[model samples]
Target: MPSLTAVCRVHALLDDSGSVGVTAIDKRPVDGPVEVKRLGVRGDVQASRAHHGGPDKAVYAYADSDAEHFAGILGYEVTPGLFGENLRVDGLDVTGAVIGERWAVGETLVLQVTMPRTPCATFARRLGESGWVKRFQAEGRPGAYLSIVKAGPIRAGDPIEVVSRPAHGVTIGDVFAGLEPEQASKLLASPAPRLSEIVHGLAEKALTRAAVGA
Candidate 1:
């Protein structure tokens, strides 16, 4: 079991301060319990809704271990919410968490693992590091995106308990591994309804690649 170490959110900004204009990558920690809904954390605003904050990606979760790994690489201490993640969890292998896996946060809120967070230009600019997108991709520890299964309040220090796990072993890391055809097939065939759409998209990509090979 893991614990929620921090909860965060941010308001959208229109200024072109960072490399990405009109962004809300600057997330700050919020005190006490915060409401989690289908859209996202209450008060959290996504400037680029096209790429973030939808039903499938209602919440972003990152592991403390991953932050530590990045800290060792970047030579700076990475704090919770600094990566714009809505939840900072401790003692969870988020990369290894299977898609469609259900987690009970606190006593009421339930969340299902959806997809992995792919690094974007905004993420690179947040780090002020060049080639960060490539570096992050190569690292292959992209955090997990979660969809609210049972909307409720989540707060720091809430226990995260695994409620269910899909039989398919298509973990977030596997998706970050370029969604191989085999894994994609398994995910697509999974009985978990929450994973259907995501796996379908991956399966389509696999088909395209196979067609090209043919």
Candidate 2:
């Protein structure tokens, strides 16, 4: 694949479906660069399932795996899907990433893998259907949720590079694959304060289940 390139620009648009539904409205595919929008830096975008309002931390977009993949599968460069990404990397193997791994976008933007995205209520609404969350959970393709370690401006076409790998050899994908909400509670009761709140919550819930079984 291509090594790296500069992020040309960034763009944002309103979800015309009144509820920020999915569907490709504006994108460039032929003979030029495509447009990628930021998902959660605004007051309107939130993680809550209620249609209220919140910051847009996770952004969902259509798949653009390869030129052929887009053309054959998605029919375009930017199809409407679900993504909780701060930056829509053009050519990064995003799903293959592990937790605690670090990657730099452009030059100043650095991010660490915090968690794999769990589908929320708004996502189902956006997809105009239900049970989509179960589909993700079943397949283990929950995508990546990142924590911004160094805040920086990001844009489309920006080059991304891995700066660090996970120390535990556990990837973000693995955590998502293993997470059990009920059992996550016990993980929180433990003394591992160094873990992120979400991670601890998942572990604690799993631990609770184990205790009950024991």
Candidate 3:
């Protein structure tokens, strides 16, 4: 099977909350090719960190991962647009994926697509674009949340592969779709262990409450 490769990895910085520019965090820009940098696990990007974007957050570009056939989702398409993703993956059809699905990137990192990324107020306000959150909710294409199994540096041209599938048949999309406290708990309590202990504990509490109600 063909593997997913990283086409572009972009990091944006904000100057005191307004000026947003894409730059190389590590290596310098070279002739025709932007120098891809070696970003550490939790190094801070001044602009991004100042703007509240995670230090390790990066936008990744993938060649193919969209299931929609007719029209490609346009930039400014969803709430955050093409540039909103911390890691933009071209070949990952992660929109409707389930929990416990394992993906391997370049043999150095293993990430379990744990949950769907919800739109936060910061995202809406930062973008300052109208209908941002509504657009993403309408399409139900929320990107997946990654819990890093193995930490390592990633650059452009890295490949992504699906090493394992979720046994429960529920997708990551299902986990986030109208996920009430009870449902979230059930998913976490399932045979397949949750990727994050924090999430698992939250689920357990929710399950306890649900049991009390029952």
Candidate 4:
């Protein structure tokens, strides 16, 4: 069954003047239940509200399998929260999950898949890998960012249920890269709520460019 292997939270606030002035990208696995609020997990703060956090991106969820794939390429053990994910899920098609999909985590917390993460300069610096952003973008495995639909407590080893999936067929991976104009049209036409503004804007741009070129 799909479940949360690790529930992580901001472990430290490190200087990242290049992007956000200060960063809270050092997420570490936390013991016990962590309260998930409307904006994000409790005790966690986003460094850049302009680009990183808000109601649309309350929590970031990554597939552990995807992390393992990166581990193979990076030549290092990819631990839970190493990529700054609040929840490391296993046995789930995270990137393939359609936008507006709703996940029932543990008991009460409900989250809706909203958008795919875009790697930042701080993320690259945190990874200590040269050409990391391009590399990450090329691989196109950026995890899904979810909006908190129902705030509650979440802990490690909690069960994750994909309670709903929209028929739009716009997966997190598709939105991240390799999106065609038709797919972009479908995404924009989706009636499901809580889709992020970034995603909507991307679809609009792609559709408009396609229309102009036609």
Best by lDDT: 4
TM-score of 4: 0.97
Q: What is the C-alpha lDDT profile of model 1 across 1-214, one tens digit per residue?
A: 6999999898456465543467887787899989999888999998877787889989999999999999999999889888889999999999999888999999899999989998988888778898999999999889999998899998999999988998888889988887777777787677665563665687679867977988
RMSD of candidates 1 onward, in order = 1.9, 6.5, 6.1, 1.1
Name the runs in model 2 displaced over 4 angstroms: 1-44, 47-63, 66-86, 180-194
Badly placed stretches (over 4 Å) of model 1 are: 11-14, 17-20, 196-198
- Root mean square deviation (Cα) for candidate 4: 1.1
* lDDT, candidates in the order shown: 0.87, 0.47, 0.49, 0.89
lDDT score for residue 205 of model 2: 65
> Which residue pairs does candidate 3 place in steric collision?
58-86, 60-88, 62-90, 64-91, 97-171, 97-172, 98-171, 98-172
Displacement of the residue 198 alpha carbon in candidate 1, Å: 4.3
- Residue 141, candidate 2: C-alpha displacement in angstroms: 1.3
The stretch of ten residues in a row with the least summed lDDT in candidate 3 is 24-33
Lowest summed lDDT window (length 10), candidate 1: 11-20
Q: How many backbone clashes does candidate 1 have?
A: 0
- If both were scored by TM-score, which would come out higher, candidate 1 or candidate 4? 4
